[model samples]
Target chain A: MKNRIVILGVLLALGFSAQAQKYFTRDARVQFNSDTPVEKIEAVNKSGTSVLDTQTGRMDWKVLIKNFLFEKALMQEHFNENYMESTKYPNATFKGSITNLQDVNFAKDGTYKVTAKGAMTIHGVEQEITVPGTLTVGGGAVKVKADFVVKPADYKIDIPGVVRDNIAKEIAVTIDASLKPMGK
Target chain B: MLKKIVLFLAVAGVIGAGIGYYMFNKKVPSMASEKSEVTIEAAQLYQEFEADEAAASAKYVGKIVAVSGTVLEASALEDGTPKVLLDTGSDFGVSCEFDPNTKHAKTTFTPGEKLTLKGECAGINLDVQLARCVVVQ
Candidate 1:
């Protein structure tokens, strides 16, 4: 009976591993908007990398800070040199998982509301955050769209008083990624 | 003398404001006119980043780099930005996102085609990424 149980356990592990699939994309887009009564600021980065695992509901995302493009060159310089310090901390990352994986069927084709909770690391600061988004599974692909607000102070990003009112206290962030199954 | 002094002050203030306005509204520089600070092959660049990210980032990131490699894949971003992947003999390739400011001679490429591109390195995220890229050849 013990041998049969051990055999069953091993078989179960193998089956789970075999069914687990990873989805990935290197062209995810991340956009952030900062709007105040005095001014409006927007920036975007298109080459974000992300990965998702079906079995564990784990997701990982990363984007290079210097990749974020601004319309005004001086604003971009101030952002990289003064604010983000992109050279010292070149990347921002999020490593988390879907909290309600049961709501979304990875094998089926439809849209599901999902919540992702994870640690977001920016400017060398890590903070836990929950983001609400929608996931659509269709035609051998998965699409993720999420909108969340981030406070610069929470990330230790300080804006000087000179342009304090020009920048928003809470910046709105949007993420869109279409992931495809990783093929062996 | 007071009238002349007041006129001088007004002229100086106008000049200062003009400089400030120009600086505030300056546009991002075009990559086509910028010189490449580092010219390295895709495999070597990827190897350096893989071996040591900080060292590679300090050496390459935020600088205009020229990478020559065989094209693995060419695709456009959802926002219509052209992106090309250069094979680095690894699972991930050196990725280049073309600059929208500069007009490219060609936006299409066949796999296995060799090309050199120059852009500002934005560090690695599984794959090294370059932004505001311009084709060298």
Candidate 2:
């Protein structure tokens, strides 16, 4: 009887602790730019969702590909129909953990450098990447910012030779998201 | 023969100039300028997306839609763009992001006021999000 009671108590404590460790946000902003000598293309998607567990340093992020908005309608159509093939692959997701979690003080208000290593899947292709970012904790909120470069060839996206000179070989991506407590 | 060649070159130059002007100076289309593919209520829209996300995406993704709902929340984005979220009677709702240059002068939406908007559907995440939305009524 004593062992049974101890097990129940431990399970209850684990549930509460697990709930406290999660931080999430629904409106994370993700932007990307492809700049070459001939053309400059840009898009922004603000419907990103992300969740982070402070206890385990596990993070997950998802953004819908069709949500990216371009200035020109033609570019937007081309991005969805030709480049990303949103009908086939509607979302891009990242699953990884913070490698430098020990340096981050979740209870304090400060900025810490973080390294995230994980697989980022875009256009049905997955690539393992490690990128450095910054985490800012203030006012009971957490802000994350990161910049990385991706090659279209890595994602099986072929650029036609006709527009090869207009598009860059490496596309620069930027992410900025502010996260608040979950279930608030 | 030389005169004919010069005439042909002049005609080609005129056509090239016209094409260049249209390509570089085309204006971005406004949300009100296009027809919506679907018209749905806020609750129903969210329900469809939440029920079967893949089917909902196939039906509404990359299409213009008109949604009518009550305003649950309104806020300015990081870049001062206005965003209005419609109530769906659940945790998830419809989020409408307006264009930066859209006119919202002297406009204030009290919570629970019914409003209609049109925009391009961008699939769903936590919400059925729409971009470049314009107020229809």
Per lDDT, the best of the predicted structures is: 1
- What value does DockQ give for candidate 1? 0.84
Model 1 stretches astray by more than 4 angstroms: A1-20
Native-to-model Cα distance after best TM-score fit, residue A181 in candidate 2, in Å: 0.7
Tens digit of per-residue lDDT, candidate 2, span B34-91: 7888999999999999999999988888789999999998876687677789999998
lDDT score, residue B71, model 2?
96
Candidate 2: stretches off by over 4 Å? A1-16, B1-13, B24-27, B106-108
lDDT of 2 by residue, A100-166 (tens): 8999999999999999999999999999999899999999999999999989999998788888897
Question: What's the lDDT for residue B28 in model 2?
Answer: 54
| DockQ of each candidate relative to the true complex | 0.84, 0.51
Any idea what lDDT model 2 has? 0.87
Q: Supply the global lDDT for candidate 1.
A: 0.93
Error of 2 at B52 (Å): 1.9
